[model samples]
Target: MKKIEDDIRKIEEEISETKIILPYGVMSITLFDLEQYEKIIVNINREREKNQNLEFRKSLIKKYKFVFLSKKRKLNKILNNLKNNKVEFVPKIESVVNKEYLQKFHTYREDISLKENSRYFLRQRINCCINKVNEELFLLNFHPSLYMNSMDEYIGGDFRYRYDAEAIIYEDVNILQSESHHFAIYTNEKTKEKTKRDILNILAYLNGTPIFLFTQNPSFNRKIDDLYQQFDLLDMLRLRKNEYFKEETEESISLQLPILKNYNNYSVVLFKTLKHAEIVDLYHSSLKQFEPLPRCVFLYRVFEYAASVDYKVKIRPTEYKQEDAIEYYIEKAIGYNPNPLYYMDFGSRKVTNYFTKLKLEARKIFKEWSEHPYKKSKTRGEIIYNIGRNLVAHGGNGEHNMKYDYDKNYKHINDVNIILELIARYVIELLNPGLKNVVERRKIYYEKQYTL
Candidate 1:
């Protein structure tokens, strides 16, 4: 318990001290992990109340209150007041008198062009920041009073409105300076406080504001690196591609190897640039060309093959006698055992048995590599095979559990697609023995998948 407590304290201290470095002249802000911080704050408050330590509680409360109020005041002081700073001018109305009929009328036009111009400028500023970030930025304005009872009919009534301003800004730019006018919309007293809080939250998350404390220190770089690696933004796009293929063909065939390879290439580029929407579009377009197949049959085959491979590659490997385990499972599941030496031995058995045969084939390949005294123990083919197996057998669910199970298996339709990719790469290498570039293979695979 003491050791655990010490570890927790150390982690908390490290988190508190971690700082991010930004480009020169930029101020960095520290964004406390909001979820964790909120939990801690709530627990502390509860504990103080439970202990009935009035004086101590009051002191702590007063200290935090002052700090909060002071920070709020500083933010408010820095904000630009759009309403007050705006200049208003009315044009003089001239009466046109006609001598022949003695008819006179006054012409008036309220020129809020300056206001409109200022709004446009604000919008441009926002857009520019977004463009810099290279990602989508949405804006929502709830200026009810400005529109509800306005003299100008041009103003829309009290309504919630949202707009997508296509802008992508890097995470290190000053969002406040770039979108100053957008922030000014909440100048009214009714929404000012809420608006300020929202702005702070955005600024904190962006961690790009020049005044942020976190960006000042180099230590924060590792945290940013960890964040980038944590999420697989490419998976959703790949899943969508699989679904599209499933729908188009009426068959849930695993994505073909060539297609998966291409997707990986496309994914690498998109992920590096954060172009998620483009990846989705590419997936839809690619799936539109595939021929349809029976969905049920495709899904069943996928599951059967996945389960067989999972048993051999993951489960059988750990058993006391790997070959015996493979033989036992093959006989039990398929009512037959494979010779493991023949190339066509794969498709001759039940789909599950086929997977077992494929695993055996892979093992043979590895053994051959090992037997060659001059050859490397692990070739690229071996690496790709192992990766493909792990991806299907472990990827999504393995992060949480250490125990192995056959039933909670990698029998998903997508696994077959990955396997196909490995097979295709292997075949391509066999044909082009001198070709050593994975990127070229990836590009070729992508092009073929696009055609499919």
Candidate 2:
């Protein structure tokens, strides 16, 4: 058997010692009142779908008032229930060493409030997916109810929506080597989609830093919730070198995933399951010129290379291999340090082909965005922290000193990592155009919501 991770052991110890308490003093789940809580949950979820008013939803929060007892305090009651034939009982193995895995089921809680109950379905789906992967779960996360996070960071641009999702993170000491560590992160749908990408960036965080190992792909199986594999940087760059050589269309049933549409009261079971398939297609198609990477990934890479040259941060490739060919290729693919041989063999061609396409596509994207009526340039107040408030140029253009928002012009430059993220499917959708089938299918399920 694999050795239990030490951090996980400590966390399990803490959980066992502390009696859990939900927000707003909603009594803990230590004891069941001999009622099927699932039925109550179903009813609550139903009302949430039908209702839309924010106040009404807030009012529903105070409904759960059941008193709960600790496992030890409730043990005699459980035995009495079994004695009276109210329930079936099983004997506990007192001699066995106590640990979380030793327990039959590990129940975790998210927000006990009614406001975000819809996410429970998403969590259930993620849980189901994890169960399929067969890895021993180490830690699980649930949402916090009643209290929205007190985030003090600056909010510059308006978002489509801001939401934080609850997820489970598994800690493994060393799946590959004695020195290396591994962690698996699983979220309930939208949690993976952060509204505002920060300066610190997503990849830098998910690289298994602070807690565990390096992340390559950070992508999961759409059909089955498997651990995200590291994106093969070398392989992806080589594809770039080859002008995005793509494999022939090989659609299979396993690629299909049922999409959730809130119109069906947010049902995951799709009547037509090709929504994910077509999305997978569109996402891949957008990156065909770059290969095995997303549109944003290629866009960022191109931007990085271009800026590196302009700002003189760029290092020209040279041939200096400390070891063998494979190791050399791996280093070259990482693109941190470069040599002339790398450029001649791969970089020169990739850069040329990539820049050519990027120039054309970026122009079109800019034109469309500039012409859109409802579109507001989300660049205002972006440089609020700048000494000049907004960067200013005292050229005295027409009359007074000209106001130049240098930050807006240098948005990507100001933030070196503007859109870094795990190459997950939900993330892919955020970058790619929606496929026709997926778009059309969305109409049936996005029933107009009356609820907030």
Candidate 3:
């Protein structure tokens, strides 16, 4: 009971300084001043209920209830945790005003129906409330094998990409290139778990080298607590002196392959869809393995996931092996007009010839393991499914199983990985065609970088 009383006293002292002033003769109320704040909240709810405009009501709810009420709940949680003996707790109130809310805020401010003074007042109020929540918070994570190249545009500093619109200028994330290993630090608001998942998915699909990281640097969150200086925060990142981070030999040479360069143009919808797929978990599992055999097992799980999803192409039930479904999807994906394969100019020679050469080599390797007696009888789709996807995964049908000799078959596995990567790229293209050009552009750049 004494502990609870002490926590209550501390919270009351903090709450006294938390009053936010609104425009248009509204009373100032701290979040802890529940009775007064509740009256305002109730009034907003009533307005939302009575207001006939469906869109206007939605705007009110998104801006007011979703943003402010959520802050109230978070405050309560922080106080509760404090009472439970959790020390050094700071309210992450800034999280509520993320990219999603910023869009709504801009939209609301632009309405010609609302008086200019009223709009000005609301904007000021919002800025005042949210800006206080800013303290140069960085959610940090380190990659094991994969590293990033510095862009010519942002030399010395990290490559910062803003997924959300430029309306909120401060909202952007930096993928930093340290000495041998790479780490990413995101500004604005993201929980550590969500940031880990987001960075992994971005690296996996965009770069094609699925990499894993040690747990996030807990020190960054705790060390920077109440430290709001931008220069001080940046100095810590440059040092990169965390015990968790260490350099390792690059596993997949595929990291040298061309990767998507321009990520700033993509919408939140793309990210949300990628998260929903949850490929990172499978890729993370694959990356933890030292040998290629176990790696192939988890890598196949990604293909298996794609196979399980619904697509326009329908296969007969008898024909629908896990590999077959994915094979069909890959074929359908590559058939897009202008084709992603030709997005970059490799040389005067047609790209088809290059792909054909690769296919021929892959086919010869496939011949050794395919169930079919005659390699000539099988289609391109079948070769990819049987050899690239399945053969490396679970050794081929007859005597030439890949698992017998890791060193001898390493080249074969790599050759198969190239073909499989193309299939994976096409799968991503199918999901969001807007990314095709970006993905191809990055691949071309990476190829040049690798040769250099």
The backbone clash count of each candidate, in order, is: 24, 16, 3
**Could you tell which candidate, 1 or 3, scores higher by lDDT?**
3
Cα RMSDs of all predictions? 25.4, 22.8, 18.5
Worst 10 residues of 2 by lDDT: 170-179
lDDT of 1 by residue, 144-261 (tens): 1221111111111111112223111212111111132231121222333333333232222112111112233456644543443332212212342324434553322221111111
lDDT-based ranking: 3, 1, 2
Top candidate (TM-score): 3
lDDT of 2 at 240: 23
**Regions of model 2 farther than 4 Å from truth:** 1-35, 65-452
Q: lDDT per prediction?
A: 0.28, 0.25, 0.39
What is the per-residue lDDT of model 3 for residues 1-452, given as tens digits with 9 covering 90 to 100?
A: 24333444554455432333222122221122334333444665566446444345435433342334434544555444434434221232232223343344345444433333233333354444443222111110121111111111111111223232211111133344333433444332232345545555554444333343333455554333222111111111112222212435311211122333332432221222242345545644554444445555666666666566544244446556654565565555444332222222334222222233344544454555465466457755565567556676667778767654433455445444544544454554555444445444323443454444
The lDDT of model 2 is 0.25
